[model samples]
Target: MTLPTSTLDLYWLPEAVEFSTAVTALRAAAAKGADGNADAGAAAGTARMLANQRLDFLQTRTLDRAVQGLPDAAWGAELTLAVLGTGTLEHLLPAIRVAGLRRGLRVRCWQAPYGQWRQQILDPAADLHRQRPDVILLAVDPAELLPDLPLSATAEEADTALAARAEEMVGLWRTARERTGAVILQQLMPLAEPPAFGHFERLVPAAPGALAARLDEALVRAAARERVLLLDLGRSLAEIGRRSVGDARLWHHAKQAISPAAAPWYGEQVGRVLASLRGLSRKVLVLDLDNTLWGGVIGDDGLGGIVLGQGSAAGEAFVAFQRHLRQLSRRGVILAVSSKNSPAVAEAVFREHPDMVLTRSDIAAFEANWEDKPAALRRIARDLELGIDSLVFFDDNPVERDLMRRSLPAVAVPEVPDAPELYGQTLADAGYFEPVAFTADDAGRTRQYQANAERRQGQAAATDMDSFLRDLDMVLAVEPVTPVTLARVTQLINKTNQFNLTTRRYTEPEVRDLRDSPDVLTFAARLKDRFGDNGIIAVVIGRRVEDGRTLDLDSWLMSCRVLGRGVEQALLSVVAASAARRGVERLVGHYRPTARNGMVRDFYPGLGFTALPASAEDQGWSLDLRTAVLPQPRHFTLALSV
Candidate 1:
């Protein structure tokens, strides 16, 4: 029997080509390929463009088939997500799934009973509690949030009502956290169009617009909690424009708060939040120099000849792009240069050019040699101690961009618009570097890596390993898991690939559960040296097993920056002592091999553990406390806490 064709087969089409002749040919091919046998790239490109043009084009059947066709492993990570909203959100699911697929996430979405916001959260036995999600998105509409407010209400009444509603909202978030331990993504109330008071809306403090602003402020304060993230749907709506984003007729007929036209925009914002949670956020922005940073080639144009700064229109555009890059640098995104120009020539532009906003100091690494860009990018990744996948490369040359995309599929190589003026907005729209939480560590990460390089250079110059270790003046501070360090600990567990024994990943709630459990001991290791502080370099999670006689190491990982600085030994010593204090007679360790963690395959056995044969794929090792002792590092001044 011939089965009906599915739209899922068209999801892999290539984007539109520029040539009119090519477009005509592709359009003909697309028509002929409608039977699911067309060129996969062309079909995918057609489907994506159509989906963008009209969200209704993304059929539920297509999404279901696309999801089911994905291999179990294609769901790189599972994110159990629950959505609670005042209006119908069933129409938004397909868009959300499309966004999730783009980010390599499998989003299992659960929708709350319609308009049951308060009951679903307040009732302990609600289905939301039974299905513990990793993330909860609260999408209550503005009208529902301020249901008691009247247009003619007095200022005092409005103020009181807003305060009470804000309190209730925050309390619900706290209650949800206390019950389910899921991270909350709260959507700020959307701004209403055509203000109730017309031109006098700002004059009336009790007006709907004024009230919405007050509620937004309150939500911002509530979002300071570690597990809470604010999704700026109001801002997204404003950017997407109200004329197309909100449909009054749809709301009146179907209670759909957002128009189908705006579902894709909403889904992108939600997907970014999910990506940040899974640590898929891009860390580095590798930029090309010629025509990318300035109006012309640095090698040929010289420092004084390049079109940069404020005089010409083209020059101002480049400056605007540079200003944007500088803003990104301030917010913890590492920037680097990868160009095929002479190192001296490129250095002169950054060092001497008055129009340059990004100096040499702003870049984490600069590679301006005459080598293949793919090789240069790999070198930059190695020097920065980051995964190639964590990079986003931008080059003005199509050849260079295509080479990067083909050679390194993992790195995001965004197409640069022909005009330099569009560079800033193009990069902003890409949303490759979205962050979940901007910690002090993030702000100082580039400086930290630079300091690490200095430390490495010092280590190489030392006469002996012992001399190098002593010169580092390293200090290892070990502390039991606490609320203050819990976030970083969870981040390390998810992101640290190399030097990770067992390579286990955990969510924030799981980390908290382990920290609070009596049978488990978790500790975070912070290291400092003559150069600077490497915050939370290592973490050890152990569980008391065999009736408390054994301490089984569930996870042990260290930052690559402190790999050879004796921090690992210091961390293990503290763990062993803590176990001994708890009356543990033996220490058990396991190593799970992965493509990235082969460096740590022999980590347990090298630490004086005997191999224990097990049927499981993970290799097991054990150390008898009676016969084993913790090896103290001679260089580190250690402080241990139980």
Candidate 2:
């Protein structure tokens, strides 16, 4: 299949093009254009398949036919999305399942008993109580939860009604979390009632439209306070088109809150959010130099010849794209450059160009060399110490993009628009950096990576690893994982891969459970060197085994940026000391091999743990905390919380 570059408005963005024409060739091949496998890019294909198609039956059959099935083992993570709603959910399941593949998630959806959203949660015998679900989506209409007020009702009466609904939601959320330990998501009610007062609709506090808007606002605030994710179907469908928002006739006929026509888009939004929680979201944005970042070739055009900045339209477009990248960096998306151009020539543009919204400091890794774009991309990943999969490549050249896709199948390569102005929007629409919630650690990610670059340079200059570590004067501060530190600690547990031993992920509530359990031990590690502070780069969780004195290591994961710098050893020192204080005599650890966590296979052995024979590939290791002398911190001082 030919790739898009010369045409974008007519291509990828499902809403912008004719649905049937967009997938004519895609269907002939695999979902992702690879072996007609349903596990591939069916998530992306399903959206375009259902968009602009009105027949719900055709959408269901086509989506089901296209998304044959994705095996649970096909993805790195799997989750059961138990959808509890007051409306129809069967037509939406196929699209939701396929869309999850876009983020390497195998999503299995379960529809709650119809119109029993309350009984389902309040009763322990409900099927939802059979086992723990990873995620629970409560998609209910506002009218189902709140009372309708008369037009003559006071604003206080509306407020009273909204407050009671919010209270009930919190009760449901708490009950769900306590009962099932699932990440709860409350979908905001769609404002489907036609304008009762036109422009004056918003002023009427008791109007259906106004109450719907108020409920959304109230749900956002309550969800934020209660640690629940909000699925804004109103916003998602409104973008598709007003008609896709909801059809009153459909609601009356089949109780469909959202049009079945927009199921693909709905699933896409959901998949992105769920994938983000699993740490499948892209982190690094790798940009090409010549036509992608600027309008012309830097080698021939020089600094003066390149089309950039305010005077020309393309220049402003490039500036706007750069602005978008800079904004992403501020929100914790690491930025880097991967170009096949002279190092000096490319560096000169970023250094001297006045129109550049992205400065040198904004970039965590800068690769401007004579190597092929693929090689440059690999170097960028290595320099950042991130897996190649964490990157999203944006290049204006279709050949280069196609080459990267074939070479590194894991890396995300968005089809750049022919027009420069569409670059930022296209990238944004691609949804590479969907964050679950912005934490303090996310806010400092770019700066931390930039500091990591400085540390790499220092390591190269030193005589040996020891002196480099000693000269840096590193300090590791260890704290008990509390709600204050829960987000970052939970993030490190889910996000860190390479240096991890037994890659076990935990949701936020699970982390809190670890903190509350009397027999469990948890640690959040923060490292600071001479250069800058690496915020909460490591996490360790341990649970007391059946043998009271043995503490089984449930999880241990550290950021790759802090690897090989004695940070691992230092964190282990604190962990051992903490384990000793809890009357833990022996520590048992396990190494579960994953595609990305192979580097940590010998993590226990390196720390002097005796290998125990295993029946499977997962090897068990044990250390005598009573007799085995833990490594003394010669490279850094340690601080412990009281």
Candidate 3:
């Protein structure tokens, strides 16, 4: 019942934990915890009721987090939590509704047809387009549900069967993607360690290694193809050592004794990941180099002594950890490093380490020095020039983490482990780092960060700004939304935060819906300087208003990557000319301010829009379409068709 640190609590992650424990408690309360000698008999009768009450409480808490986290403007949004197959859905649906009603979201659970029913819940194929949800949570395992026969198999063998089952699952997901634009995400099989076979295990296996891996591969591959998200509930369970449903003793201790005052440990983790995924943008991963990233301190151990490689246990763990980070970096996570070691030592390890997954060039920023981490983080923020809050900091020392948490609190700090093996799962479990989608720019992040460092160092040595700009040979591709570039455009609208003018987050469904509206216009801007191609980084959303004579800017947001280089003007010009050609009377612009959006408070005024004093709780400003002058840059050119 304690208030969570953030409204973005992950209730879904703990569904398995609470449910398993509730079942155990129901039996226990029914047997011993009830009435006298005759009362003891009565106690057995009340046990199930008591357990159900506990189950109801846990479910209520889950709903509370979701309801509390729903953004005010998103109230009345038709939210649907779809439990694809049977298991926890029966219990979860009721709790989700209670939570949804409290939050003002019109939420409903779509129960899929049982054997006798004629698909009472509309087929995803039929209802997806019309029954759009702000977010979709799928509890069923497609890989398990796909036509397969492995009832007699052990967990490991079943996992093999599941992997073999992936091709079909992938196809079905693709079909689902074609049908609906709603965000699709699958929950990990719950942790029921030393899991026994029955209803749940009969459908799927419990071997964490083979089964989980195959399922993960299947889910991640499907997510990549269908734009679905894979949230790791299994990893969350393992983190707390709640290995299996039989770990009732551990669950009881966790719930009653160990950390009674803390937020439900399970729910908190779930909520954190969910909130982050809901509002993901520019997934820049800034790693720490030293005892944190590797095993031993780089400065003390020396480059050769630093723990990494396949030889030693610690070295192997570090190597494995580095590989994982590199994988994330490759998946469009911008990689950077902050360390208190000498740059020479850091570079030597990056370049010379045989087992190293990342090199000196992979990092966006290599801030190594005597300066405290917050200061280094500031430099990394300035070098990348992104809001520090967007950066995810990983450090071995709790002191450094506390520094950032206390000083610049917005940055996400996943709890760090002393040992190396735990590093892989802890990082994976921290949802702050999860990316919903990847673009070409994401894949090239390491190289871009390396390029950024070189560019900045080059700029520092240059005599003047104009000389630097001219020497960079930056290429800008200002173009209208195309079929190929549509995904990145939607990603920008959904993710880009710091430089976003209005901070209006959009779902892919809404972005697709824009296609049918004649009044709405959206554009994706691609930038490639002498540094590197920054993929698609800017999105501008506006509508033709005033009887189709004027274009009014509804949302104009850009990733921090392309901010400093005067791309905004090119973006505005793109919109301006499109409006000019459309025979619109004028182009109107607006700027509304939020705490994080203050960086662009003067954005509209800078673009020649008059700032009106007309302010509401969510402030508003406007510029007349007629009075604004369209500024075109000789350096930037546009290629687009309205």
Candidate 4:
């Protein structure tokens, strides 16, 4: 047989050329004509091909290394990714693994496939006790594959079957989750037109006009009932037509098979999806003021002349972008501004702009000065008492963005979309802000910040701690683990670290099991003051032993927002009162130290609990209920109705 000739040509060849060079060497071996050994040329060519391929692999691997080295300031403290199963398991598996490698994650990926209506996904998850991933990405496109499932003959029948299937799937996931473990992330289908897989065509076989609407509704309901994270990639993808193989809009697969130019963009789309899922747990959205949120430099635009509304195209774009951010803020995204501008000018624009969607009250904190953007961001995080890793920084200047990207390394610095009009679309597509539900407490976040600012200002005026506490009009709501606060409590039990005594994270299923079991007691806290309400911000889990006579504080935590405001004291007091009422004679306070939880190292000791010397570590403490003082501070208008 004649030998295959070397006709290979490739761009972006690594330090050592792969296919091309290997083919060339093979061709050269053939030309040499090893007559004595007939297989000599073939052997040489095979060896050359292997070497080149290895080199090519090494080059691609280098890229991953570079990504791993990305500073914490670039993406946040840790990478928390929610893997959505687009039913594109073949396509997503590699990408998810890539995103997970070496990334600091609290929970790993959540996988949901459309073919089995989550059954396929659940079977694997049920056995995930040992390999507990931080978060689950239910990235299945139900619109694409659900039609292949067994559908009921009638529309009502179909709806019932689908709902039941969804409920069962969610139930399995809930069962699989450990106490204070695994966040469930569901990515909604981004709308793509026909010519590709035509998922839109199949969105609703039963209803034509409301197909997309119905799917969205199903997803929303499924997410809520399952207590899963919902990233709105659909809203953004709907605006920009989804690229499909049929349309040939995105040559992702072909490019991967061919070149690197196509590689980055294709990888970027996947990365964008992953980034959105990862950012769900991100605590802070740090923004740049000049040119990022508004058009023109505030110092140069003189505040009044700065373009920010409908009259101009750029201004309208910014207005729309700000509205998108406002939507995020209303969904519990903490907003902070870090701008290199005079506070006077920045404050004026916010005050004067009639069409401006954001206000001074909307921002959690504002760092306005000549400080470097990265430094300003660090300060913003410190002032807000959030981790630098919890920050997602957005800036217009490439230099500043790059500076922070390299130095801080942990913050998520999404590459800015080239055009101004695409800012909202790009950000939406990026999927960084996914929230399950917008509660009343979320809507009042800005007002809460304003209240905090007022309280801080009032601090200087107060002569004593009692007078300061009395002036704020703080209200504390203490209750048992009810359905309304269960979601928040579970979230705290899993995510809260610094103020967590015992550092015990509970899963929803575990919490539910606790509620059912007679031996366990769980409680949640809600605090509202002259500033506003912080809904279900604290949680505590306890177990009763010796016939309801003794209580062990299994898990206790409070959100840092209400940290300094005496919320912790109030929560513990309520727990103590409840335990006393339950006829318990003793209360136990537990502490377990973690790398980040040094803040709570002395929590039990500070709470006046006697330390137990049973273990070398300060693992346990106890207080006699009869003698323990109930810290019922008069400043808090406390009412317990549980």
**Candidate 1 residue-wise lDDT, 1-642, digit = tens:** 112333233435444233344334445555555544635345445433433322233343354343433333334566888898765776766666666655556678888865456567776877899889888899877765652333334567666667766766777888887888899999875653323222334445555567887778877876785458988877765644544566579899989888777788778867876887899989999999989999887777666567775445787688778867875775578999999988988898888764577889998899989999999999999999999999999998999999999999999999999898989877777788876654555445335334543343323223334554686678888888776466567878898888898889999889999999999998888887664455677889999988999999999998775655567767777888888888999999998888899888888888889999964568999989878877777898987777
Q: Candidate 4 deviates by what RMSD?
A: 27.2
RMSD of 1: 29.4
lDDT of 4 by residue, 1-642 (tens): 111222122333334545455544544544444443454435333532333332333433442333332222232234344343433453444334333332422122444322232333334432344345566555556553232121112355345544544554456457445422667666677433211101212432332213445556776887787677786777655433322212333344453332443455466546644554565346578888878888778797564456565335787678768866774664467889988888887888788754567888889889888878888888888998888887888887889889999989989888886556777666655555533333446545545334443344323322234454665578887777864355556767888777787777678778888877888887877776653345567878889987888898888887755554567777778888888998999988777777777878777778788987645444788889898886775678886765
**Which parts of model 3 have CA positions greater than 4 angstroms off?**
1-266, 277-282, 444-642
Which scores greater on TM-score, model 3 or model 4?
3
What tens digits encode model 2's per-residue C-alpha lDDT throughout 1-642?
122333212234243345455444445543444444553454444443454344344543564455444233334567888888765677777766655644446677887755556656766777887857899989887655544344444578677777766776787788888899999988875753233233344565655567778878888998899999988877765554544456679889999887777687677778877888898999999888798888889898777568775445787688778766765776678988888787777887778864566877887888877677788888888888899999999888899899999999999998888998888767766677876655546546445335543443323222234554675668888988854456567767887777888889899888888899988888888787664355677888889986669989989888765655667887788888888887889999999988898888889999999989885658999999889988788888788882
- Measured against the true structure, the TM-scores of the candidates, in listed sequence, are 0.35, 0.35, 0.33, 0.32
> lDDT per residue, candidate 3, 129-189, as tens digits?
4555445565654333432222223445454555544544455454444555556666666
Steric clashes per prediction: 5, 1, 16, 42
Comparing 2 and 3 on lDDT, the stronger one: 2
Q: State model 4's lDDT.
A: 0.60
| TM-score (C-alpha, index-matched) for candidate 3 | 0.33
Which regions of candidate 2 are displaced past 4 Å?
A: 1-242, 445-642
**Candidate 4 lDDT trough over 10 residues, lowest sum:** 192-201
Better of 1 and 3 by lDDT: 1
Worst 10 residues of 3 by lDDT: 113-122
